[model samples]
Target: MPKVSVKVKWGKEMYPDVEVNTDDEPVVFKAQIFALTGVQPERQKVVCKGVTLRDDSWANFKLSNNALVLVMGSKEEDVPAAPVEQTRFVEDMNESELATALDLPEGLINLGNTCYMNATVQCLKTVPELKNALLGYDPSSGGGTAGGLTSALSETMRALESGGAGACAAAAARLLNALHAAAPRLAERGAGGQLAQQDASECWTEIVRALRMRLTVAPEPNSKSLIEQYFGGTLDVELVCSEADEPPTRSNETFLQLSCFISQDVKYLQSGLRSKMAEQITKMSETLGRDAVYTKTSKISRLPAYLTVQFVRFYYKEKESINAKILKDVKFPLELDVYELCSPELQERLTPMRNKFKELEDASVEKSLNAKNKSHGDSKKENKKRSIVPYWFENDVGSNNSGYYRLQAVLTHRGRSSSSGHYVAWVARGDAWLRCDDDTVSPVTEEEVLKLSGGGDWHCAYLLLYGPKILEVPEEEEEPMVTDVTEGPAGNPPTALA
Candidate 1:
């Protein structure tokens, strides 16, 4: 036996740092070298056979002090060439490589990113059969383990169909649950399936349509109950003016002036109505008093023997006469039927003004009817034609107030057109005398004027009083009408209240 010395290098860059001792017996030497260097004993064989002494022949060897000592022999043969060193390295390991080596389903391999891979794994866990299939044993395949779990599911469904009932229920339930869980994952990947994508698109389309409809038919919140029966809900509202070239002006002055207008409507001057109206006026005065001026004027016209009551509410930050801060000047033409219930003397005195008022109201109604009739024939054509004279007041009042009153007659125009069977109303509030004969003249009917005098339109009037006094309207009680039991076949009586 010959002894040999061995050295081992480890890691990427070989470093000459490890040495091992071999015994005289090559087998024992190899084993000892392997034990010391932790290299395979078989790999150390080449070193065992190549040792020699100074005689240039095979050396006899023996172990001494954990090292090999060689003894020269009489015969020597060609020394074996030093064995070439070889190293083995395993290929780098990763998810894809591991999945491939284990023969996993290609679907899992196709997951583009780690997030999707994790999501899919989570979804599959809920399906016991699918999980088992991935783990190499598929219950769906009739007690045999198969790699084609998807195919096994399909075959199971087919068998259930052939078996005539209930065989696939549990599997179907599991698949549905899996699909539901996986849907959100697919959406994040922007890979929503065809059916889901279509449903989402349709829902968005309906929402857009609803918004457009609301914009078109704007409705107020207070009007909700009245319109909801027909329109179903409140609508989005926006205010638009006709003049495009002239931008509307708004200021704190305008706000105060408008507040004056609102004050006049809230305050009623008639003696009989004063107490109830005074309370409202007082409330409104508190809100507008800081920036507004209030004045009242009464004129007696002999021809009509009627009282011309004028209330002017002016609002401005600076001190000035009411006429100096005029934002709008409108003269409302009104007709009163004093003859309907009045003394002969009063009627005689009112004859001239009453006649003039009636003529103006009639002429205004006729003109409006003509325009409406003309519009009916060709509304599109009529819309293109500009009016030569604008009837309604066309001034932007310089105030932020919601209401005001000026020493101007406010007219209410109303009439029924034969062509379009609906009552129309037009209110004009200005300072000039109404000229009825003019084609542009706008007049208000008697009923409309009364409505305005009684504190705005019907709705506003109802709201003003409905708040606290609604409980005051006495509920009517009806007396019951009874029918005799003899007349009703001796069992019961009939009552009208029923």
Candidate 2:
């Protein structure tokens, strides 16, 4: 029995004038078709004039005694159109299926199912061996195209021959062999296969182009452009840190710590300069009277340097009660002018200090002028006047035991008092010095002495006295006063006799 079968229709029109014979026994005929056609003759039925016709239907016909035949119609004109005989071979075989039918592996079918069998066959036909096989012509025999069965047989032979050698190899090896066998042939004539290859290559090219573009494009800079573009930037000043001579790490924390350490060191230096200045001022104070104003200029102009000097103006204020004794309890305004005389070297060193002082003085003068103008424009009557006096004490009086002395002075503002008595007393105890004549000395008057001991402003006759020491006097029954004396000629006191 054949492994495959096909059914073909035969009718009156196919042999209209042929004789019929049905006397002999019919011979059963069987045929094989391509396995892909799926045709079977045994399963088919033929109808004639709305009646089913079997082999027995022609049993009574007679012509030649040994021949057997059947008529499909009574007359030729009554015959139906010749039954169409469609060849079932190669109807639905895809390239892979076709390859398999010829005993070839799936991988060898390069055109896949994307191309028609004819086109795929054409592609395969480009290869000498495959073309010879497809045309049923032996390449060695040098024959032309053969019939259908011969073509199929040739193809089967070719598939077996090409694939047989690699059957024992790994599956991948067999697949690679098949692909190599089919690729060249397909490349020449498989338009669909070639299109797919072109499309794949184009896709890969686009992907590589995209990746290259991404790599070549420049990235944006990370830092701020304003400083770089305009100022030509700089790194912040940083201190060098060492660990046994190792260079410092340039991190934010290290930089901050270094800055703090430097600031503290500066403060310490400033404090030392102040102490030294205080010490020098004390030694200078011993040589001058308490009320004598001494002036010393800065040796250096900058802060730490400028601070090392004597007689920098220091001022403070205190309130006085109405009933307080002015001679004993009143506080005085004191002023000491320290001329800042800088040595050339010191001037250069203290230039920054001088600049700062100039700035402060200008600001202060402007403020004072504005205040004065405002006060003048005010309609309210002025009852009291106030003034600020800069003053400093001799070093001996300072509590620091540095021989720094305290000096006191008065800022007296006279105003109308409603009381009958024309006097006010304001005094308090702290430090005191007297200003008299060209020379400043301690006072001799008991009242003045008491006021100095009590400490503050006092009212008294203004007398200019130039003296270096206080006069010592014993306690007496009467208050001491200078008695007026008469003068005669020759600047002599008048004689009692004459």
Candidate 3:
């Protein structure tokens, strides 16, 4: 729920105006009043006119324009405490139980209308590699200021590192500090306790930029930064015109994300990417001395381990002064295969890894069928499947294997325009999904995550982050027997011009 500002008057005294979210329960409202008047919430009953509002929630109620509300309750009341029976502290619990109790990745509080920042942080937090990289960063590692970005961001990441242990009470505060220090206008909140609605991708881009500027740890020794280490890829764009006499013009570009442009012919995400990669347009050709039709095509020169894909759904409408949405239903896959999207050389290099994935998948399917058919002997045979590839690539800078990726994190929006919408993050923690909407975090299912494909203006996927598909390698494989030809025949040498 969006935050709102309101005023409260008690008897002859007027308390300072405080901001509260209208979507929250009335108990939270009472807690706010308790801070101002030093009154216990359990003993307080808020009244508007002759009606006493229920303390459960503030539904169907408006608190706009600093509306005044009357309160009728004692300043303080003494209450008895329940008797204690059993108690278990961290000192007594094992590591697993302690971790469950702490739950390291806690939800961030929405400060006023900072949902965009909260959502962005939540989505990025899903990346354990990023968190581990941040944990390696120290404030004393580098000096000087890069737009005052490093100091604030490093501090924020430090706070986030141990969030589950309750060591940090203000993850949102640290993030807002970093954001304001880096880009003031992006973190600004206007009047009415409402912020200028921001694009989640824009915010996401800026946050990544900040981290790139600060945390310089690389996955590999010579790699640039963790941003490039995890999310960087190179694109090979080629331009060819039918009227031009010379060979096709080719160039390279770096990208952190690929935009999938929706079109009439785009029925799904793969097709949308295809439409963006290859397009025909009219351009003047110097060799032909006339405007000619040109076809521009792009392919991946390098595939990063973690891939980011943004749906090009919002565009600026100068007349409307807002980014209007396309609202098209773009279907994306849970496990994506990008083997076809790579350059010829890269595709050839990736073939071995692709074959290993196929072998594992085939073995898995066969095992499932054998179990259903009560073929335990065949199941054991299928269990002898051999792995030929490593879980990760030797050089972690590029794709691990098979050009395959699993959907990891999704950032979503819930309005028609980018400037006036709510942003949330759906993150995958192993097999479970967490839908993080500002301070309200709930468990969701994969089916619910798939429904965010943008059709009817509900929360739809705006940006997707994919991680490399990890494969287990077997210890050994069947090797052919080597025969000594010299032993077979006295005059025979091992393959001497045979």
Candidate 4:
């Protein structure tokens, strides 16, 4: 089939010279009509000679050159409730229109070598709790770097939310100023007197610290600050002196992030994390009365709703006077189960939720198989929406119920070192992912994202943000709806189908 030029008629207006390709899906034809009428494909209803057009096929209708077709739908803004039926890119729709139609978040513009800051900002915006805390932040709460950063960040987030398809350099510039003023190292210039590119993980740490100072709203009554509540965790530490005949010393420490030291043996993220958890160090031993070798062991006693993991890929090269990166291929999982990383008591506490997750997975497999068997032909399987429950603990609002998490964002660095590299943020958006390379935001596949696991000069994952995995309550024990009744006419309403 060949391309045919047709004129489309919408309510009172007519769009002529619209090109439609007969060989492609009918949705493609709708896209052509969308280009002319500003109506999204999902909301569009195409009719020709009283026969309706379906998205899957166009076999019933014969489209010819100069043929008149009827299209009906409101503009994208008018139908805000309509779901996105397809992925539309810059080639299909302009940036402004794409943002408006898909409700995609705006991108941040780079100010000189500020991609690091931009990437961090974009990744942090994925956290709803943090954004809400920032929205309620008061600059008068404190004075100095923390206050300035809080104020700047609050405004930047607001602008990013509402300023669609617009430049975000001004907000980013204020943030850069606040950060540079707080951390002098970030303000250092290159040999050419140009602003130096900084590390995204460092930027992330400083911003988290600043927000922790100003956004003091606790997740629960009489708790720590919002940042700590959502991002902080506790580690149970034990030190056994090698030369002393005494019991091991025990203590607890709070941390904002976990570091994964990447060595030659570190082939996966979990392995690196486990190696860091226990190590041999030389420290002052009170029992031995001297500096002695001791075995230091650490286990997580508390897991926050949001977890930050940094790959220790950079090492200081004294001769080169630069931090060189290691290009090792370390695989990471999209869904992570950190049960092995928790303390014994913490692991026991996390068991119930972990069991529930296992049940859900089993049931999901069964349901999928049943659906596949019931289908008459080789029809594609329908992607069923999983039942979602709160990721946080029921008793603790900002703590994880299970030692499981789903990767939400990844900050990758390209080039030899963090100081002279490009930084980009890859954030999960529903089932899709978006790559924010400074000002340019584009859709990327999960495979593309996973390829950032190093092994080459390509972009490698430097920092990862994992949010607690959404628990799916089993159908047998699903919470009863408000309409559920103990005694219904239809024998208890057939167990109130979930």
Model 2, total clashes: 32
TM-score of each: 0.13, 0.13, 0.70, 0.72
Model 1, 1-498: lDDT tens per residue? 233333332223232323323311233333232333333322222321234321111245332333433222111123455644343222543443333334321111111111122222222222222222223322343321111223333333343224221222223322222332333332232232111111211222222222222211113423211111111211111122222222222221100000113332334333312222222211113333442222221111111111122223123433432222122222222422213222344345445434434565586588678875665545564345221111101121110011111222231211111111111112222212221210112232334333543221221110010000000111121112211211211111111110
Give residue 364's lDDT in candidate 2 (0 to 100): 59
Candidate 4 wrongly placed segments (more than 4 Å)? 1-103, 139-142, 165-167, 218-223, 372-387, 474-476, 479-498
Clashing pairs in 4: none
Ranking by lDDT: 4, 3, 1, 2
Best by TM-score: 4
Task: Give residue 192's error in model 2 in angstroms.
Answer: 99
Identify the superior model by TM-score, candidate 1 or candidate 3.
Answer: 3
Question: Top model by lDDT, which number?
Answer: 4
lDDT tens digits, residues 106-215, model 3? Answer: 56554445667778777776666665555545556443344234444545456655543122224345455556656667755546433467778888888788666555
> How far is 202's C-alpha from truth in model 4 (Å)?
1.6
Give each model's clash number.
30, 32, 1, 0
Q: Between the candidate structures 2 and 4, which one is better when assessed by TM-score?
A: 4
